[model samples]
Target chain A: MFLIKHEVQVLDAKLDKLHHDIMTHQENILILTAEWSYLNQPGRIESLARRHSDYRPTETKQIINIENLPYPKKTSLVRGRIDGD
Target chain B: MVIKFDGLKSQKSIQLDGSVNKAIEGGRNRLLVLSCVFCLAFVAAGVRLLDVSVLRGLQEPIDVVEPTKENLKIGRAEILDRNGILLATSLSVSSLYADPQEVMDINSTVEDLSTVLVNLEKEKLFKKLNQKKRFVWIKRGITPMQQAQINALGLPGLHFQKEDRRFYPQRNLSAHVVGFSGVDAAGLAGVEKQFDGRLRDGSEPMTLSIDIRIQHILREEIKKQIINFNAIGGAGVFIDVDTGEILGMVSLPDFDPNVLNSASADTKFNRATLGVYEMGSTFKIFNTALALEAGTATMESGYDATRPIRIARFTINDFHPQKRWLSVPEIFQYSSNIGSAKMALDFGPKAQKKFMKKLGFLDRLPVELPEKGKPMYPAPWKKISTITISYGHGIAISPLHLVSGVASVINGGIRWPVTILKKNSQSKMFGEQILSLQTSKDIRKMLRLVVENGTGKNAAAAGYMVGGKTGTADKQSPTGSYAKSSRLSSFVGAFPIHKPKYAVLVMVDEPKGNKKSFGYATGGWVAAPAVRQIIKRSAPLLGLLPVDEVSPQIRRLLEIKTPQQKRGNQLASF
Candidate 1:
């Protein structure tokens, strides 16, 4: 009985430590999520993209419908058969 | 001694021995009872301790004792755009407070705090620290750096309290929609105020119907126009015609929701839904649609537009006057106020009032914003009122009302209420059928005509099949007369006319005439081009495929017949 009581005491202490660790981790996660959102604001990203890279937003008129695309050339492919086959 | 004892002595000795025996027996009984009671108490205590530690432990552990109430106060749920982009959120921050009664050396504490919190006044902090009160706030929303610095100071009586501070991640991008909160984290305006109770009670993020990308595009275009025209202000709204979900609503001179306290009344004003104006010829869409719905007029019905009609104190005329007999379609295409009034007179006032009411022009728009404008119309229906209102002069309504009503007319007659919250695509649409399906088709045709060849030509986007009307109304002065120089130029339009999907409205307040636009600050020159730019920039982002405008179906729907065709047909008949 004495041994069992000692073991219980040790387990209770470990459980308490785990709970505290979990709470601390949760608080950290909350703070980080807020920081993530702040960093990912659309305006911030757009300005960054403009400054750092050559990429720009695609204009609607620039996008062509599939039907508007020219048909693939049969001669561009090996005339007799499919390449893989 | 026994041998010599008399009878009385022998009796006394025996009695004394018996009494001693009785005393010993009583003492023994009391000791036995005491031991049993002690043993029972020990057993009971052992059982209780075992039950608590072992038996109860067999059950699942209690959920992590949620952080204390202060740490768990997720102030209000975060607000996200339709694409789950964060617009408004609450960050848990540490607020610095002082227990004034426990504070020692108030001057030194104040100096240390003020040094760390540069925005705080040292005198005020000193005063707060010296108060007899138990607790006083030093700063409510301190940065983490400030919190750490204050902690390093380790000043007695100073403490940190965890609090939730509302943060707008997108800043002024969607300010008027995801409004700011007060010091106590209570919503004060916009969607924050609209869904205050739900936001406070739940921790899940509230998703709005706004798309951040579209919102940025619309605001950028509107801002550009406002600067180009040197206009006082501008507003724009884009609504999904089928579902009535407001994709983006932009009001210029918008303020950052994070710093709402310093925003002026003009900056906070939501012009799209809250600023009512005489919406000029846009009302003609309603007049023409109503005229068709009532069976009093057809596309070919002609009205005399030879001259302006003089009634009482008003002369009803058109900005682009066509002095001839104009067909119903011609009347709308030319925006002839004289012909529209004659049509309205033929349709009668009661029907017009009922149609306006059905279009939600006689009451406040039921959008989620706390700032909604009540429509202004003449109380008693008069003859001249009908004439002026036919061309959108006497009756005043918000831009939101015009867009929502136009959405109903073009979106197959269903009048869906405008919503700012993201709606489930699978959810059933909610609206009443206010116009016949046939009449709606006819109206769509007429609107397409305007965009194809008439006033709204500037608003046309290639392959988008933009159909809309242009409205240029004189701003009503404080003295109740129309100001000549101040024009409220606006354009309301829908795209992919055969199957309308989106309705957009752009209104510019007091735009100045510029040299590029031939010194004409009309809706066609100002607001129409803004709408065209918005649609062009937003369509690809919205994943709308550009259709073939030359296809027979689209061509037949949007084609405008020339007057030469009419003359040729007449000659052929002869």
Candidate 2:
């Protein structure tokens, strides 16, 4: 009975340590998420993109409706090309 | 004597034996009772252990864990823009505090802390540390590097408390909308104050309808115009007409929410929703829409603009006067005050007052911002008051009211209560319809005409089908007279007139005209071009495709006949 009580106490201590570890990790995750949000502000990203990349914000004239798109043209196929290898 | 002694001894021996037997029996009975008691206690304890481990294990563990002080410190939820970009958030910062009583070597402590927290004055630290009080805040919202350096000091009484500091990542870009929280993490202004309880619960992020990109565009455009026109201040608002969700609301001379306490009251004022003004000719949209909805006027109905009408010492005239009988469309296109007054008189005071009340002009605008303006208008409905109010003089209201009212006029006659929060897709879309479908259609045509052929030509964006009205009202001077040179030039516009989606209002306060604008500080000269630029830039971001202006459907809807034909039709009707 004494041995069993001692073992149970040991297990409880282990569980407590695990719980504390989980809490600490959760706090770390929260901090990381906040840092990520700060780094990903739109104005910062836009300025960075302007300096380092070819990408720019989309202009109104670049956008068009689907109805304005041209139809695809038909092309003739050669049947023997498949067995060329 | 020896025999008596022996007999006594025998008696004594017998008594001792009997006593021993009795003692043994009593011991046996006591042991049995004690054993039974031990067995029952063991059984009870075993049952309790089993109940706790197995029976109660099947159910949730009701562990009443006490919340620590750190856990009790409420963290505010983040505020995100429509695209999930962070506008406002709460970051956990270690605030430096001191238990002055526990502080040893006060001089050294103050010296050490002041070195790490450079912003804190040494003299102030010395005075604070010398205080008889138990606690004092040495500094708050310290950087992580400073916290680490202070921790390295390992000084007694000097401790760091984990605190949540509200952060506005976009800064002044969304100052008025995101608002600022107090030092205690309690919301104090704007959306922060409006949804304080929800934010305090630290639930999921609150997503607003504001798009950061659109907000940036509007602010940049307004700033440029404010500078170019030499205006003292300006405000602009962009709203989704269908959803009634505000996309971008910019009030310039805006302050950064991050440093809100030091910002001036004027800088913190939200002009878009709070500042009330006599919105001038923009109110004509309401007058015209009301007349059409009442069936008292038609598109071809003519109003006499042959001369300014004198009514109760006030001469109602037009800015660009047409000295002839102008048709209903002509009246709207020209923005003739005389014609609008006549239309209002024909509509009658009773109906006009009812319509104005329905449009939400008689009270403060129901918006999320705490700073709101109560509309000022004449108490009694007099004849001259009707005439002046028709031209947007006697009645004063916020730009938000005008935009939302105009949105109702063009958006299938439904008046959706304006909101800053994003609407969920599953929610209902239709608001109360205030006009018939035919009347709404006619109003849209008249607005389109104003942009295509009349005063709001500068507000037109090519391929966007922009339609709107211009309003230039003179500011009421402190001496209770209209200031001639000081004007509030505003342009209220919407795009894709056939299927309106967004409504924008741009108002430049006290704009002075330069030589390039021909010294005319009118709405067209000062505010309209800014609206055009805003539409042109923000259209693509909103996924709005610019349509061909000359398309058959669009052309047919926006087509207006010549003045001669309009007159001939009017003559025929007579």
Write down the DockQ of candidate 1: 0.50
lDDT of candidate 1 over B365-444, digit per residue (tens): 87888989999999898878888898998998888899999999998888998899889957676698999998898888
Worst 10 residues of 1 chain B by lDDT: B565-574
Q: Which ten residues in a row are the worst by lDDT in model 2 chain B?
A: B565-574
**After aligning candidate 1 to the native by TM-score, how far in Å is the CA of A78 from where it should be?**
4.5
In the order shown, the chain A TM-scores of the predictions are 0.81, 0.74
lDDT for predicted candidate 1 compared with the true structure: 0.85
- Evaluate chain B of model 1: give its TM-score: 0.89
> Candidate 1: how large is its RMSD?
5.4
Candidate 2 residue-wise lDDT, B399-448, digit = tens: 88999999999988889988898889786765888888778788888888
lDDT (C-alpha) at residue B380 in model 2: 91
RMSD (Å) per prediction: 5.4, 5.4
How large is the interface RMSD of each prediction?
Answer: 2.3, 3.0
Top model number, DockQ? 1
- Give the distance in Å from residue B248's predicted Cα in candidate 1 to where it truly belongs: 0.8
> What is the Å distance of residue B563 in model 2 from its true position?
2.8
Native contacts kept, each candidate: 0.49, 0.41
